[model samples]
Target: MADTPQNQAALALQMYLDTSASPLGSALQRAPMMNIGIDEGELATLPLVSEALTGSQRLRATHAQDLALTVDVEPDPARHALVWQMQMAQTGEQPGPRVHNFRPLHIALDGSLAPDLVIHTWRGGAQQSFFPPDAITPERHVLYPRTTAFYQDGTFTIGTHGGRSSDQYMPYMLITTADDSGGLWVALGWSGNWQARFVKPRGTSDLHLTIQIEPCDLRLPSGTTLQGPAMALGLYEGDAAVGYNALRSWLRSHMPALPSSDLSHFNTWTAMDANVDETRLLDAVEQVAGNGLHYFMLDAGWYPSPPNDFYSGVGNWRVDETKFPRGLEVVAERVRQRGMEMGLWFEPERAYHTTELATQHPEWLLRVPGREHALVNFALPDVRAYFRTFIADLVQRLGLRWLKWDFNIDPLPYWQQANDGGLAHLGHINGLWETFDWLRSTFPELTIENCASGGNRLDWALFSRAHVNFANDQYTNPDCIRRILGRMGTFLPTERLNMIYGPFQRREYDDAAWQVLEGSSFGVSEPIDNWTGQFRTSLRHHLALHRATDAYRSGHFYQLTPDTDDLCAWEGWQLHDPETGSGVLALWRSASPEEQVSLHVREIDETRSYRITDLYHQSGSQTVRGQQLIHGLTVGLARDAATLWTYHLVDGEENQ
Candidate 1:
C-alpha cells in the first residue's frame, strides 16, 4: 500500500530513534526531538547505545548512561493525521544522575518549515476577557486570552506560572504554514506547570520548538524510574480548523469516557450560598425533580463551615449538623428518589490554617509564607491514604454517585519552597494520579469532576482520570462564556467540556439559554425558588433542546466565524456527525449591530439535500441542497440574540 501523508509523518518521527547514526548530528542537527539536562549536561551530547522497534507503532532508543526514550505513533487514517506520544525513563539498576529540566518535545524546524510558520495559542484563566485595554501591554502580550503570530520571529514562549497546568496558558498549540496548508498541532499532557518555547535565531530560518514540565529536577531512587509527562504531536493538512478537529478526534479516542448521567446538572453553591440547610436543599431537589437535570450537586457549604464561612472550612469534610441535622444522606436519598444522582463538593488538597486537620497534621502541610490555607501534601502516603478512606466513607454513607473535586489554593510556592530539587512537585502530582486511579478502580460507577479554581488544572493527564472539566468560573457574562467555549472547544472534546449557567442576576433568559447550548454538559447555580413560571418553562425547554442535540455535542466541530474576543462581533460554530449526516449550527449575535450574517458550512456532501430545522423559533423547517448550504446560509437575529439550527440528510439518505 502507498504511504499516506500521515504514515509519512510517522516515518519521519521514527528517524529520531535511529541508532546506527548519530540521532542529533548533521542530518538532524536542526531537529533534536527530545532534550534532557543531567548532572553531566544535555543528553544530546551522549552517544546512542541501542535502538529497537517493539511493534509497528512503538519505537525505543537507549542512549549513554541507561537513559531510554520511547515513542508511540498511532495513525488515524480516517482523519489523515498521526498522533505520537513520547516518554523517557531511566533503565539502569542504580539510581540515575539528577535530571534537570526534562523536555519531552524538542524540535527545531529549519529551511522551508520555519520562516513562514504561524503560531496559535490560548490562555486558560478566569475572567481573561474582562481586562481593560490599558492592562494589555506589549510585555504582557502572552497573558492575553488568545494570540496568533506570524513567525519571522526571534523567540516566543507560552507557559503556566503556577503549579496548575492550565493556570496561565493552555498546554496546546497549532503551528501552520502561512497559507494555512499543513502543520503540526502540539499538546502537553502534564497536569503541572508546563512550558513551550519557539525559538528562531537571528539571521537563521531555524525555529526551535520545545515543551517541558518546568522545575522537573529530580533523581530516581534505586530500581525506580522517572518518566516525563506525555507529549502528543498531531500532524494535519489543510486549514487550522482541520488541525483542531484532528487533535480533538485524537483526544476523544484517547481520553476516558464521561459518565452516562453527567450531561446536565444543578449546583447549589451559588443559589443557597453558605446558608444551605436540609429543608432548603430538599426543596431545591424537588424543584429540579423531572426537570431534565441528571445530577444535583450540593457544593461547598454542605460541609462543616465555621461561622457559616465556606473558605474557613476547607478541611472539615463532615456534614454540618447545624445546617443538615438529618445529615446529607437525607438530601441524597431525596435526589435518588427523584431519579437523579447526587454529587458533593470537596477540596481535599487544602486545609485552613485554623482547621483541626491543619493543626493536627502540620507536618503533612506544604506551607508558604502568609497564606491563609496550607496545601495538603499528597506526596505523603499517609495523606493520600487518609483522603481515600475519608472520601470513600462519605460516598458510601451518603449514597453519593459523583464527586466535584475542587482545588483553590496554588501549590507552586510550597513546591518551590520545599527545595527538594523539584521532587516535591513530582511526587505530589504522581500521588494525585494514584489516588484518582484508586477511586476509579474501586468504584467503577462513580463520576469525578476535575475542577481547580475552575479550569486551571485541565490537561490530558488529568482528563484521563476525570470525566469532564469545568471550563471557567465566570458564568454571569455571556460574552465570557462564549469566548471560553470557543477557545476550549478548539482542542478539547466538546462532550467533556462543562460550564455553569446563572445565578442569573441581571442576564436575560435568551442569553442564558444560548450559553447552555454552547457546552455539552452544564450545571445551573440559580435558586429554583426565585424562578418565575415563565423562567421555569424556558429553562425546561432549553434543557430539552440540549438533550436532543447530544450527537452534535460529540461530533466534529468547526468554527464558522472569526475567533475573536470583541463583544460586538458575531460568533458561531458547526457540529457535524459524518456517520449520520446530521449536525447543528449555533450562532451568537453578541452585541453586534448587524442582524444578518452569512455562514459557510464545511465538511458537507455537495450532492445530498438536507432538512434544516430552526430550533429557537417556530419557523418550521426548510429543505436545501448540500451545495447551496455549503456555499452560504443567511441567518438573521436581533442584537444580543442567539439561534440553533439543526440539519440532517433528506429522503432516507442520512444512513449514507
Candidate 2:
C-alpha cells in the first residue's frame, strides 16, 4: 500500500527530531533544534538532556549549567502539519554572556534529499511590481507577485530590513522537490525584524536552515529569559499546493476567529481624508448602513489635528472638536440605529514631538537620533496601560465594534538604538502582544484590524492577534489589487486579506474592481451616495454575492493564474470547500486581447456533476460533470473585465 501524506509527514517530523538517528553518528546525538552562541560555545554543541513535559506535547532540553530550551509541538494529522513554539532561557545562578545569533529554527537536513530541492520565497508588501521608472529605488521592487527562487546548493539569506516583519520579505518559506513528490513549508511567527538563512553544501545534500531575530546579542541575566521567535513546520506530498493548503488550513483553524473576517466594511478615509465634519460623517454612515456594509469605518483624521497638519497629530486620540463638535457618539449612535457597526482608526504607536504624549511623557517614547516623531514605547508598562485605558474608554463611549490599529513609522532604528542589550525589539513586541491581549479580554466582541502603513506588519505573529489585515495602502488600482490577491493568497488565507477598493475615477473598470474585491474580505472607500446608478447596483450585487460565498472563501484557495505583471494575460483563483462540495471561481481578463480562456477546476471529485452559476453577471446556471469542469471550462471575458462563479455538487436526484 502507498504511504499516506500524513504518514510521510509524521515520518519526516520524527526523523527531524531524532537526534540519535543522524548519519553523522552518536557524536552529534545532542543536536538542538535551536542554535545560540554564548561565551562558552555554541548551545547546540553542549551536552544536553531532553524530556517530555507531562500531559503535553512539549519537550524540554536543558544543559547541566545555565541554558535551557523548551519546545511545544502541536501535530495536526488532519492537515499534515507540525506547528511548534521554541523558547531559550538562562537558567543558571549567574548572568549569561551576550548571546549571538539566537535562532529558534536551526536544523540540518540530510544530503540525500538535496538534489531535487527548490526553494520558494516571496517579498511581502504592496509595491512589489513598481520597478525603476515607476518607483524611485530598487527597494520598492521587493514584494509579491515577484517571487524569488533558489535552487539546490544555493546559499541565500532573506530578512526584514526594519521592525515591520514582512516589510521586505515574507516570514514564510517553501522547500519542495522539483518533482513535487515531497515538500515542507516553514513560517516564522515573529512580528519584528527576522532572518532566515538557507545553505546547501556544494558537494552534499546537507541543508542548513536557520531563522533568527537579527541584530541579537543580548545577555540573559540569571532569572531573565530570552524568548526566541515561534516557528511552524508543515509537511506535504504531491504538488506544492498541497503544502500551501495544509499550512493555510492549520493557520485558519489555530488562529483566533475574528468577527470582522466575514463582514463587509465601508471606510471613510478615501472620501473624507481628514476633512471630515459631523454632518459629513453621519451622512456617510447613513449611506453605508443599508448598502450591505456591516461596518462604517471613520478612518484616520477623526483625531484632533492642527489645520493642514494631520500627519503630525497621531498621538492625539481625542476626536477633533472642530470636526465632530457632538463627538463620535452621535455618528456611532446613528450607525447602530441604521443596523451597522462603527469602526474608528487609531495610530497609538506614533507621536509627533509636539503631541501631548511625546511632550509630557518623553521617557515613554522611543526616539532615534534625528527622527521627529517617536514611537510610543510599548516596552514600558505605563505606555501600554495608558493606551489600553484610552482605547477602552473610547470603545465604551462610542460603542465601537471595530478598531483599525495603524502604525505608520518604521521602528527598527529606535529599537536598535535602545540601551538594552539588543533585546529592545523583543520587549516591545511582548508589550504589544500584552496590550492586544488585554483589549481582547476586555471587549470579547471587539474586532481589531491590523494595518502598518499598509502591509508592513503582515506576518503570522500579528495575524494571531488581529482579525484581518489591510493588504496595502494601494486601494485605488484594480490591476494592483488583482495581482496582490493572486500572489498573497499563495500563503495567506484569502478570507483574512482585507481588500479595500475605490474612490478612483476609473468607471470603466468597475466590474474589474468588484471582481477583485469579491476574491477576499473587502471594503469600499468610496461613498455609495456618490456612485452612479449602475455602479451602485453592481456594488449591491457583489456585496450580496460576497456574503453568499463567504463559506467557500474560508476553504482551500487555489490560484489558477500565474503570478505575473503582464497586462495582456488572464488571471484567476478558486476557493474550494471540500466539506460542502461547493466553491467559488474568479477570473480577470486584464487588457488581454484574448476573449476566451479555459480554466481547469482543481480538487474536485471527477465522478460528481456540478451546478455552476455566474454570480456576477447573473447568468443562469448549468449542470456539467465534474470531470469536464476539471478537464477545462471555457470562460469568455472581454478585455478589462472579470467574472465570478459559484459551483456546487448536484443532488443525487437532480443528477439522475
lDDT string for model 1 (458-573, tens) is 88878888887777777666666666676677668888877777746743376434554466586677766666677677778887777778887777888788765466888887
- Per-candidate clashes come to 0, 2
Q: What is candidate 2's lDDT per residue for 369-419, written digit by digit as tens?
A: 788889788867799889888998999999999888988888888887786
After superposing candidate 1, which stretches have Cα over 4 Å from the reference?
A: 1-12, 15-32, 41-96, 128-153, 222-225, 651-656
Looking at candidate 1, what is the lDDT of residue 333? 93
TM-scores, one per candidate? 0.87, 0.88
For model 2, give the RMSD to the true fold: 6.0
Q: Which residue pairs collide in model 2, if any? A: 111-205, 111-206
Give Cα-based local distance difference scores for all models: 0.72, 0.72
